[model samples]
Target: MPRDRPAPDLPEPLAPLIDAHTHLDACGATDAASVAAIVDRAEKVGVGRVVTVADDLAAARFAVDAANWDPRVYAATAIHPTRANVLDDATKAEIELLAGDPRTVAVGETGLDYYWPGKLEGCATVEEQVEGFRWHIDLAKRLRKPLMIHNREADHDLLAVLIDEGAPETVIFHCFSSDANMALACVEAGYVLSFSGTVSFRNARDLHEAAKLVPDDQLIVETDAPYLTPHPFRGAPNEPYCLPYTVRSLAHTRGQDPVELAEASTATARRVYRI
Candidate 1:
């Protein structure tokens, strides 16, 4: 594992904001006290609400527990598409139960990841991923919550499957990694795009364009913590407190004020997740 870099200093604060998607467990926020401390730091910087997402049963449970631990925290549960091969009936039942929790606001961090499988052994097959994704979509619709998606090198299939299966009332492309065209298509479909630290990298020109393409109401921001730490702090440990950096970068890309963008994202998140 890559050793986390020294934690970065706080960025300039924004008005109270929301991390639409994050991973507190992966960020080493394991217990109530730790989760509280993390949220405290975020609150200091105006990130007042956070939705921690899960990739599997263990993480899903942790997300729910974290939410119950703090009112500022909420949860989104699912078997990540990369782990789709493991979505057995028992696991599905457990996720279904968790999805029904009032604090569980969405049915993902689930979708397709074609980046790792064929090049690496022991990855879930495309067929397995598709099966799991469809199941998750159903859960989102049944539960009347937004569907939070994780699309990596599988944009075409992700959009196709969502359209074919009929998307839930709300859909969020978390850490959206597609180009301008895909962003336009998703916008046309009324899906919200949640950008992450990747948007801050100078090399992410296409993502910058996509960020610009997304209307203020359709845009959101996240840390995707413990990964995708923003530029100048790349490879550093990321947490919700670090979100303002990405928000500022996103605001720059969209030619909007940071505070304005922050307000829009927070409102959009609350609306989509029904928080």
Candidate 2:
């Protein structure tokens, strides 16, 4: 992480949008006031609500805590696919307890991640990630909450497992990275696709096309903040407030009005997350 990079300036206010996924903990928010400050910046940029997501035991706990701390904040809890090796019995028990919290909106970021097995030390293998993803699917179904997935270079295996395990009623592919074909497949399967800043890059024509194909009901917009900051500020530090840039990019890509896209995505987020 580059400590010196500053957060991007607020985009032209696009009102009442939601950053469907973010990490306040990674963005240097530890306490109630810090979370509020970050959300304050977001509100000024016309992004009002945020869903803080967890990637591990500590983050899961903090995600629930942060959601409880601020009314505008909601939470999604799971051990990320890369860290699936840590999903032991006690871990599952605690996460299940957290998942039952009213502030917790979804049960994920826990699908498949084949991108880090050899490169990252202690990363889980594909097999372990698959088992963990199945457990998360069961948890989400039992709770009647949406399943939020984190797919990276494992789309084929990921989709296969979702099919084998029987997907939850609502599944959200957060920061959806596949091309138009996969997007079409997911749409056909009745899954929701939540786009992030990565879709805005000039070289991301595939994601651009994927963005254009999603129906309004199945589409969502997010920041995935502190990572994948939108273009014109791609390498800069990101926060929930940076969501508008990606929303505008999505609107431009889809050839729709920005405010209209914003409103539709906000409504979709409400329906999918029930937040």
Candidate 3:
């Protein structure tokens, strides 16, 4: 069952919010009417834009079509690391063409994930994952776009690969869950850390600490919606409308003003994604 919805409250201010990373395509939430409904709710809560990610070929087409239909929606294309084995030469060529679309802003939602062993059986081997990630990295660099990374329990290997291959012009670590040291390393490498609702959990002290350590310009916020709903609303189906709660929590951790945090994050999102 989806989580319970809490009584909605008016957000502090309707400053524009940008959900830097979200899987609108993969979550069975990418249709026009549904997308419009979600965007409307986001607009009501001050969210101005969203970068909907595609985890596979069919979804990539949906992402592009949706973005073309809605000016506020942007797209990111990549074969998710877990599904890397499915990426054939034809798929790669198609993705290259898709990446050239104006609305396709980044190249990812890709990286390594060892947490669910065998979950990607016959989908992608570790070598395939590495090769696919490197290909996307190169694509991002060539296209002069940022890369939205998803690293889950594969930080060390992921970092090593990025360092060795040299990442793209800009890299955003979405739903960052690594410890402070890894956070520091990423920051030092000139990467952006996008915090999610998980950072708002009471027991997420490590995330909070990492949030505090992240420089203002190098930080961004997201809902990773339909997942990682913020505290006080945990278990609920998350949407861009819930961003303010996560932003407020992030501000609290950094001892910054909520409005300022919102503005800075929006600007950072625009600058990074070139939206």
Candidate 4:
């Protein structure tokens, strides 16, 4: 849904934010024209770079293609935790090949998700998810790339696995919704926590607190676009251009200037994704 009115004016420096995690491939709103439109809108609000994550092989290829279509766009490839069962040998080989492409900067959106109790059709069990996660972790290590993880109600298992297996160059916990203790542990482990629009929700006081606890260097902001749109726009289809709202809210929570937050987050994003 398009905004009925223009977004509120951003401070001069906070205008050029970077959405560290988004999903153009999933949105089906990222064609040449749509990309140009999105970029234009983002630029108008100071959103400079967008990292689009692909969940499966087809989506991964689409992310690479979208990156090719726009200089400002970057791509991450992985088999999502929910779809971990689909990672057959052929698919694994294809993903391995995709990693070599320069546009493919990271491996994942892969981790564990135990929030849904029932077995999802064609979805992997926890054991299978762990195995798939390990495979992607190995690929990230071999490729010397960062890893983008997605954990939901499986923090203990996820942390245990990462600690035992070690991590790639960088491990980013995308859409970090965990509590402060886990956030602290992740920080101590040299992992980055990427906050999404969820942090802006009034009910997400815990997330706001976590944001405050996160070190500047270990913090990044994202839209997780077409998913968790920020407050005032929640439940609406999210887009990269809406990142400033989340950033603004994060800055407020952290008691930092919006421009400083933007600059720091952009730097952190670059460090993790090497974008």
- Which window of 10 residues has the lowest lDDT sum in candidate 1? 1-10
* Tens-digit per-residue lDDT, 66-168, candidate 2: 9999999999999999999999999999999999999999998799888899999999998999989999999999999999999999888888988988999
Local lDDT at 120 for model 1: 63
131-174, model 3: which lDDT tens digit per residue? 88998888888998888898988989999999898988799999
* Candidate 3 to truth, TM: 0.93
Give one digit per residue, the lDDT tens place, for model 1 in 1-275: 12568988988888769998999998888899999999899999999999999998999999999999999999999999889988988999999998889899999989999898887677899999999999999999998989999999998999899989999989999999889999999999999999999999999999988888998788888999978898889978888999999998888888898998988899998888888
Evaluation by lDDT, superior candidate among 1 and 4? 1
Candidate 2 weakest lDDT stretch, 10 residues: 1-10
Which pairs of residues collide in candidate 3? none
Residue-level lDDT of model 4, residues 1-275, one tens digit each, is 43454444433335557888888765555577787677676777888888888888888888888888899988898999888889999999988888768987888789999975375666678888999999999999999988999999999999899878888869999999988888999999999999998899999877777888999899989988878888877666677877888898889988999889998988888877777
Steric clash pairs (candidate 4) = 15-46, 16-46
Q: Would you give me the overall lDDT of model 4?
A: 0.84
CA-lDDT, candidates in order: 0.91, 0.93, 0.84, 0.84
